[model samples]
Target: MRLNHALPPDGANGKPVGKEGDLVVRDDELGALGNMAFDLHSQLSTTGDLARQNTFDAATQLFNDGLEAGSALTVLHDAWNTKLGTLKEACAHISNHLDYSKAQHAKDEHDIQTGMKNAAGKAMTVSRIYDYIK
Candidate 1:
């Protein structure tokens, strides 16, 4: 399966040569993904709490009335809560990891730029930079 058609094809020089050749990700993109994950986590937590509160009384009453469904409802509620917790944790992890990745990449770029300078504090030429990479 062609999973990623967006990637550029190799050029004659064995280097990627197309619009998507360079692996580029903007800070805003990472921030937006993180924000979305955080929003999903918040929404899930809020909805889960509201649903649990709305059902708690009914579940308790059914159990008090000694119905088989009460036991079933309690079990279902517990299972739903467990799944919801897992989902929330995953969303939190995604958000936190993205934030960390964005900051780390920025730092990496800064370090790379800083390193690409001569001892006299001049920026390295393109050919010189390519030589170092090669």
Candidate 2:
């Protein structure tokens, strides 16, 4: 059988040349996910900032004792913001990596197709010679 013709039309393992798997990150889907992560980070960070400002304002209006509580709360707020930043970075990284993978897969598929075509052409040449000799 011709090597080129024997394989699936799309590519190896039934996947298309540059398509993403259901479990793997897709370009469009991952982009959306990254956007959502950014939006969440923005919204949450803004809310946290406003809440902290309001609490501090209220505490200062009340008495001197509230300063210590506000100081303690700052630690928790910083930690939460740090975590949200990490999450946003991770989503962006995933989206970028998947986009790179899709391009690489396409290049690899093209190489495979070229190799198979060459092999098939060579085989045909040899077979034709043998048939002519007989």
**Candidate achieving the largest lDDT:** 1
Q: What's the distance in Å from true for residue 12, model 1?
A: 14
lDDT per residue for candidate 2 within 1-134, as digits (tens), equals 01223335645675433333323545576557656755665665566456655655555554456556656565655676677667666755665665666677678876664544334565334455456569
For candidate 2, the C-alpha RMSD (Å) to the true structure equals 11.1
- The estimated TM-scores of all candidates read 0.71, 0.44
Model 2 whole-model lDDT (C-alpha atoms): 0.57
Candidate 1 accuracy as TM-score: 0.71
User: What lDDT score is found at residue 29 in candidate 2?
Assistant: 68
RMSD of each: 5.9, 11.1
Candidate 1 lDDT over 1-134, as tens digits, reads 12334433443454344543356768999999999999999999897778786576778899899987888888888898999999999999999999999999889988886668878888887688888778
lDDT of each: 0.82, 0.57
lDDT of 1 at 40: 98
Once fitted onto the true fold, the runs of candidate 2 whose alpha carbons sit more than 4 angstroms away are: 1-66, 117-134
Q: How far is candidate 1 from the true structure (C-alpha RMSD, Å)?
A: 5.9
